[model samples]
Target: MYPRVILKETLYKKSQQKRRTSPCNYKERIFMLNTQDLTYFEHRPRKRPTQKGCIELSHIKCVEIVRSDAPIPCDYKYPFQIAHDSYYLYVFAPDNDCRLKWVRALKEATQCNNLFMKYHPNFWGEGKWRCCHQTDKLATGCSEYYPNGAKPLPPTPDPKCRFLDLEERIVVALRNFHPEEDTDLPLHKDEEYVVVDSSEPNWWTVRDKNGNVGSVPCIYVAEKISNDIEKFEWYNKDMTRTEAEELLMRENKDGGFMVRDSRHAGVYTVSIFTRASCIYRSDGEKYPLVKHYQIKETEGENIKYYLAEKYVFSSIPELIRYHQHNSAGLITRLRHCVSRNVQNSSRIKELSSEKWEIHPDELILSEELGSGQFGLVWKGYWHEQQVAVKTVREGFMSEEEFKEEAHIMMKLSHTKLVQLYGVVTQRSPMYLVFEFMENGCLTDFLRDKKGCLSQEVLQGMCLDVSEGMAYLESSNFIHRDLAARNCLVSNDHVVKISDFGMTRFVLDDQYTSSYGTKFPVRWSSPEVIRFGKYSSKSDVWSFGVFMWEVYSEGRVPYDNRSNSEVVEALNAKLRLLLRPRLCPQSVYDLMQWSWKEKPEDRPSFALLLHKLACLHQDP
Candidate 1:
């Protein structure tokens, strides 16, 4: 049966032929969506329209939004794709609403058909399929399919329940609520509601005591518990301010205590005891003094807490708990009391072993090499040998976690991988000693020597990184953040992969990040960017971007786009532009091979290393 015509509009169609040669050219066309097919007509302004193309409803496998990164000349507001049998028809709409209307209509039209089973949310057209290895402009090698190369049956929808058996939660409005939308429920202060559906984390559908049934923001209400003890702990303070202070003083034997900031309401300042001279005293003589630890409030008022303006915490309890585990800042003095008790802990023992541990005194930190979220990297001397010392920021990481990371780094060693020498755990900021690369980071080196660098040098760098990645892949490790910035170069121009902070040892080669973990978007694979699912193949995707950076002389990938834009562009199946005049097409082909829509379709680092080696030999 043919799909009904729901909408028709005059739009510009990006010519497939023109896109390959002159990407800016767009022909005016009239797009019509009917029950049976999507038909496009050539728009001759003064004359009658003539049908140019039609995509049958039966052949349409998928319809999706395209967030293109490609340098298309026309500023088409909303670009989308319709994939059918190995080929994708890229179309652009005048607005986002128009695109959404078309996409929704198309999805609804195919909902009852088998074609709907092959639908993908983000799948868009890539130049060609890696499976068929076609480079020809007009070649359509393989049909559009999912990662597995088979069209699976559509998922069974969840059974509809007439009435949910979930508990009816009664809550009172904690504050005045204003509804942003017609479907949103507005509540007066102290108004009550019985929660019908608390499925959504932030918004809950509630039936008010007044019989109103609408969604209300979860933060606007509080649970209506009968007993004071069952109420929110923040509101359950029975002790007087004096009594609270007394208890806090007693608990904080080492002199760190939290008190409400006199200057700011709803803000608390943590004062930690330090031997440093008080602000009032300029005398060199040091005495016990309490100093306020700078706190940074993030996003929502009660949600996030940052210690010393660095370590992030979800709440006050989380912040206090972290400090209790790993005393730092002015609280470092308390380490004598804390570390002495936990010194024999299994984790500390694992990191403190004589073979892997180095005395803090031996690590003479020199000039700072670089700084990151974790801490700073310094060019230093360890046992008279030059080393790169990466220090974990005082409160950013706990002692136990830092030690575990050190243990993992020590286990990994390869010629093309930076070697972790030992860890210095005697101080507040723990030091991880590693083999110092005389040339510093690869990105800086490449950028500094940009036009002066030879193709052979760039090719060698790619091979070096691929070899390092291959070793990690074989060892069942996924380097989640593999880029030129994370790779270091030696005095002899040997490039070795570094930055193992995001690396994980996985038995299955796939590692999913915990919710809220931030990752660089430009170098990430589509799977990694969308789902945070990382594997060696994902690393290969990043390696492709890294190779682009190398060839471009350290130019940032998607330099013109924001992280969110880069993520959107990747979802659209757009990739870094190839410098055909500067680099060989063969090398660019390898980059494309790594950027296949399917992660499995991407080449392994081992295969990539072999190919790079072959390229090196040919050069």
Candidate 2:
């Protein structure tokens, strides 16, 4: 039969390889839909196309959206599975719109096929089922078809519109809108609305599909393409399972392995070595070997992993790192050979260097700048220059911890970031010398210049911080404690991100806090507060709060609430009030963009800087 091409597009196909623990490796492919078959090529055509794979339309059993429970990359925005017989093919589209189009077209093309009664939600790629973690790769564990499986009938003519009505309508909920006057609509996250009017620049009048009509800030509605996959540069790279496992194993020696959890969707638990012993015996064995422990999910959304269950961590790596310091139990004493192997590794030596150490006499302490839990910051003289010296308390931080911080500080130097000069380790109280800011912290500066400073000045301050954060993001650094208090203002009103105390140098840009680590609750993102997970996106969340502080002239966020109260409010999805009069609508929109609940939904600092520059340029 002569084939009729129905649709064609550039899409990514999940490779059939299980080298690393990660689910699948996505490769760029050109997919084409035809009346007779669904085929894909290795690349775009020029002279002749090399066929990668194809499936006969008659063999197609089912096609449906991959649920959130599937073991797939968080960056894979539009995932779907196509099952034929017992096997499945997992594919990813660039956006939701593209994915929907493909799904609709495929359903129409294969309407007459004799399909299977059930379909697996996950793809059986390579030699195993990545989602179910089943070793029998060919086994069809379970399947269910979508209720709306049949091809859609032609649309009925609308009496109101002779022409096809194509005005864009979006379903979204208000994230941070508070009604001030009687006419303003009090918007909440639960209420969904359809945009009826968006002609006015930054404000839109929406009719709640459920029958309420009111005007709301355009930024309050969540964008439909929040997790657009094209935003990531590494979305097209393909890696084998072996490469992933090798990388994970090379990074650390603490026996890390990923396993799918049956109860949770899109969640996996990683097992790591723990120092604590298992006191409880299993299967008539007393004092059983407790070499490893699985990361456990705690109450609410918090996750912790430990053998003693006393210390909880947000991620597996955090738990492993913590045990390296507090190695007190039978496991540590027994695993001498393994510990020696890790210690002798070149990575550990490179991280423990003392090149940053400075002479005690080089720094002359003057007046104290500020004091905190770690120690004090002093306005000091170092090498004939004014410097801010941070002195570590005698009992607060360990030697290893200090070295880690110093090592990280030495590698980073940016104009918008407070530059670390050197460290004084010979003295009783160790000192970290940094570039001094004449105007002190941003909080006090903003509070002092309230009403006097123009909106352009405030916008300039945000741009400065965003530039610094973009640098940090590029360097794979996460400033967990990003806030107005942690930022310093130069004499010329340029803001520099300071207080690298909570900063982490991460490979994947994700850092999980160890148990009992104190984080500023008010400025923290939802993930940081709930799961103790810190990333550049979490820093973006804090940046939103910081922007709010700038616009409100440094007023305390959630001022009337206690730390516990703020946590409760955050859990209930309440956000800071919009400063309508003080801040421009455009600036408020940027702030709301940063506060998206899903970390991936938030804009990167690079994107944020661009948006701010565009807003500043606008008259």
Candidate 3:
């Protein structure tokens, strides 16, 4: 009351002090700013400190840091990041396409040394790093690291792959393809001057259009004739249709690599790496989770390289021999893939055991022909004719067992069957020679190049197998193993049923033995596995699984379960779920009919063939 009566100017001072001290009242006096202002402050470029020196700030992390800022074209790109010791290098491009172009440039410039140069403990390989670097430019002149081009130090060797070092092992975006060349090389063979069109030799007049002479040595004009064999090119494994076409166009425009042969016209070879797990099929669907693929590359008749996705073996013969004994050592097989210093046949021949010799005179052996449970296979020759020779370990199976296997194979002769050419059954080891199939096994062909084969192609495989089965049935033979890996393919789409090691001949259509080697129960009829008796009808049951294997791109049937569990489930009359959806309904219906537990209930192979033939005609 006394203060009110006094009503002094001190009261106004007190109120003003209170407003300044109160948080809510203080905030009311200032105008509010939006997040937009903060964003501007964050991205507004300020000069980097000068002391940083010659180092370009990577735009890779910058966009992420200032994400709210206005969009830049670089945000969509994949940055190349290389870390060496304490320093980290980053390269950001406008987009994936630009990134790929940059990568290509680096690859061309580095000469297979760019990846090693970019990483810590710099290292390189002769032709090893082609697929690893996105770009070929080396970071040079920096005192902090990689100073004076003193030849960057070699990488620490990986204990697993002794021949390849840490930085030397590279992961790249593209695969390389080099086809076999004919013995002859023409004048226009080089990339610069590929002959686009050539008419028949002008022998009409003594004086030609350019005043060519009549009597010249065969060598004088022979170079002008095109002699190179046609080639097929694979560019990038992950390429989209549009990207593939663009690459083709680029090849055409640049005129860097040209194929004069009509078969190789307008093509680019895509080199795939070892870890490459996906393949884009022509059907617009990408195949995912692939484990491996068998690859073959030949140059003239002198050199060949067997490439398993990324792993390259120096010679097919060595890989085959190694693959035979140790199936588990997949990567070890590639340790020998080194740069071609010279053409040495005697040295390679010396690498193998005295019992096994890889014929250097035959170029086909240079190419990686195929692989199997027994060992590495090669396209070889005997008596000057092409053949596939499978080399095995020294003490693999007893001679008696080898003879038994040979006897089983020698008796069979069917167009749909891979014929046994010869056998090297010496006391020291065992080897089998068979007719070479240019296209490789059906399992590999489908895995590498996937699609619904043409109706004609499908019919040919089906009919071929049917014909083979017909022979097996008439001879009272049972092909206990009838999967894709055991089947070979000819260039003409003909199928040959192979791998008859487990084959047995039955006196009748049933078995009385209480126990024997357990059948391939996954493919065997339920009655055969559960009841332990088999016949042609049991083979018909296996044919159903074979059909499923073909349709599903050789995916393991009932992939999640064990072979024993599959037998147990089938014995219990529980239906094994077909996982892949690509199988046709007709095939599914046929499998259900053939897989019935009662063997007698199954349809005949001839009947099944007729039904499958009908699907081909309609589908």
Query: What would the per-residue lDDT of candidate 2 be over residues 194-280, giving only the tens digit for each residue?
Result: 666554323456666666666675545643323222232211123333443444345343322222222344333322333233345
48-100, model 3: which lDDT tens digit per residue? Answer: 32221122122111110000111111223243333323343333443545444
Clashing pairs in 2: 18-241, 19-241, 19-242, 20-241, 20-242, 69-265, 69-266
Screening candidate 1 with a backbone cut-off below 3 angstroms (N, C-alpha, C), the clashing residue pairs are 2-35, 3-34, 3-35, 3-36, 4-35, 86-143, 86-144
User: Which structure among the candidates has the greatest lDDT?
Assistant: 1
RMSD in angstroms, all models? Answer: 17.5, 24.8, 28.5
lDDT minimum window of 10 residues, candidate 3:
6-15
Q: Candidate 1 vs candidate 2: which has greater lDDT? A: 1
Model 1 alpha-carbon miss at residue 252, Å: 17
Per-residue C-alpha lDDT of model 1 across residues 205-259, encoded as one tens digit per residue: 7777778777675656655644222122222133334443444344333333443
Residue runs of model 1 more than 4 Å from their true location after superposition: 1-347
C-alpha lDDT (0 to 100) for residue 486 of candidate 2: 88
| Order of models, best lDDT first | 1, 2, 3
* TM-score (all chains, Cα) for each model: 0.46, 0.47, 0.40
